[model samples]
Target: MSELINNRQERIEVMKNLIRQLHEGRDEEKVRRQLESVLQEADYSDVFLMEIQLMEEGISRESITKLCDVHTKVLKKHLDLTETPDAVPGHPLHTFLQENQALLQRTAHIRKKIAELEKVSEEESADVLMKIRFLLNELMDVDKHYRRKENLLFPFFEKNNLHGPSTVMWTKHDETRSYLKSVIQALNEAENISQKEMIAFARLAIEPAIESVEEMIYKEEKILFPTAMDLLTEQDWYDIYLQSPEIGFCLYYPEFEWVPEGGLVENVEKIKASDDKIHLPTGSFTLEQLINIFKTLPVDLTFVDAEDTVRYFSPGKDRIFDRSRTILGRKVQYCHPPKSVNIVNQIIKDFKEGKQDVARFWINFGGRFIYISYYAIRNDQGTYLGTLEVTQDLTDLRALEGERRLLQYDEE
Candidate 1:
């Protein structure tokens, strides 16, 4: 007992010294090696707090990136101790990573080609602009990666009371998104860019976006992931694994199967079956059926198609705005208040003209505030049907929180 106590005390001292060094920005490489060695031998719970302390002390991004690979190796080794097989190819997470890998590669290729084209004379710049436009369209896939984390992973982390790191990471994600959008806008408007201008844009816009993604991976592997591994059960991970494919990944490829720990393989099939249905009070329905049901909802929905026409609308419950049957055949402008008619017409015209797709307005009425938004509805073919007008009451829906696991019946 005395020997074990002494050993524990020694490990504590080592952790404190390493953290001090990292905080002081002294010998980061040596300190990182020592930290990794400590992690390999210690219980995760013992080192977890110290690791967070180091992170709080401003560890270098380069150090974080290097440690990410180390953490992956450690996780793989630990996971391999279990008898479960690896996750299959085209598994949700796997597919996400695969898709994002292609996007990242394409973005890099486009950047390189644009750089080469910059060296040519002014007459050849048009070809470069065309290439940049193509790349911008491809780079829009960044939204997929952001949505996956925000929609899927963040919820799980929030449930575990790990909000601090999650919030920081989310803020970083937004910053990266803003940078990408700025670059895309600049690239679109740029008629002639010299080599220096292109290089500056690449540094300011493209590289930062990539670095942000890479840094996120670092945080995930070292902090968010380990916390998740500790807090979430195998079932939780399986659920995430199942849903991940929908949102996809960013520059990732998985080499292992993700068979849920201690669960039967058939469980994956069951999850897939249930995932295909939308559960409602009355009954479950297929995806297409659910979409149609939402369209037929009690409130009226008017969609400005990609072509900036009134293409589709749904009737759903408790609609805040009035949608008359006569408005169905008319231009979206005629449906609005005359005072705001010009703005509506302008929004529609711009959407059809590919200038803008979203317009929003809100107002207080009948002792309650209402929020209304118009989203340009476009299909995969880039065909604009019209704008979707969604208007909802802000009173009751804004108060939702916690889990609603039980059923409540309401009689008409």
Candidate 2:
């Protein structure tokens, strides 16, 4: 009732007491009443602050993890603000909301296919497996969504002193990730998958994962987005948008661009003033010159170090595979799918053993001739360094039967 209780420290203490009481068999209604007295009619990030404080006071993280969703349920009905955030098309929040909607649709399709299999004969179920597999594959693409939240958005929450929510949610992310993996594995292992097998996998693996994902989306839209909207400034959002491309987009890409009012549209200027020239054995190249050289290359190149870490990927005119800053420190094995990981490993093994200098894959993809190669990098002394992945589209080159001796301008 007093302003003194409104102090965040005091509120956190009250929160701790309330949580303890609730765990000690106090009446749920009374606890809800206590929350009602403290919360104003708005987004409640104080809940985040309270949990962060409790964890800082030596409470185990696992303890808070278990109570996160439970306490959110308790606080849900007591809060006045239950409206979904109003994010414009170009806004980052809108993109996330769109992705969640897409994920829900994919899950619904998965469930529907599984339901159809329940009543169908084994032959009929056979027809459903391909559809189920496709949907499940799309669902695994939720990784991009989760990675963006964990790497990009969560850091902002931590910066704004809302540490506990991010930590707890990250734990839940892992749980959902495990569930997703199980579902994928189930589909992968299915041999003659009967109608019964389809039903069983859906119930045991797919259903639980889908439920967890949907629940997380609910919590995020209800609590996380609102709290972020209340806390982050325009510049904070601009920084997030600029960095988002590094994590890649989820199911939905923004339909419009959001420009911060009176703000510069680029990253804080990073002039190459500190080191203008890069010296090499051949000669020296200016920073600008070296950058242009990489851009001028006809193929896309990604360099992986001896540590199996992605160091750099050239930004060419066109790229065949996506690379993000998040991939910088990630193991090369994880960059591929769960199945192709073995082939990748084998290639690396062959290279490391000096048995092979190159591995290549060429295919006709989407009516284009695509060539992919991995070359083992080594020093003049033949010491193993790393590997370089080079990809090129040779569609035009393959089609060229005649050569142009001179450059000539033709009338348009």
Candidate No. with top lDDT: 2
Q: For residues 1-412, what per-residue lDDT tens digits would candidate 2 score against the true structure?
A: 5665467667667778887676667888888788767664323666777778778877778888877766777787754366778887777888899889988998899888878887787787877877777676667666778888898888888887778889998998888888887777666666776677678877887888898888888888888888888888888787777677666665666658776766455434342354687999889999889998998898999988787766788977667767654455445765675557679889888888899999999998888899999999999988879999999999988887877899989574
How high is the lDDT of residue 167 in model 2? 90
Q: Alpha carbon lDDT of residue 57, candidate 1?
A: 59
- lDDT of residue 174 for candidate 1: 73
TM-score per candidate, chains pooled: 0.50, 0.69
Q: Which runs in model 2 stand beyond 4 Å of their true positions?
A: 1-18, 21-43, 56-58, 76-81, 255-257, 265-345, 348-355, 361-412
Give the TM-score (vs. native) of candidate 2.
Answer: 0.69
lDDT of 1 by residue, 43-117 (tens): 433344444444555664345434433443433443233332223574444445464556667667766865766
Lowest lDDT 10-mer window, candidate 2?
265-274
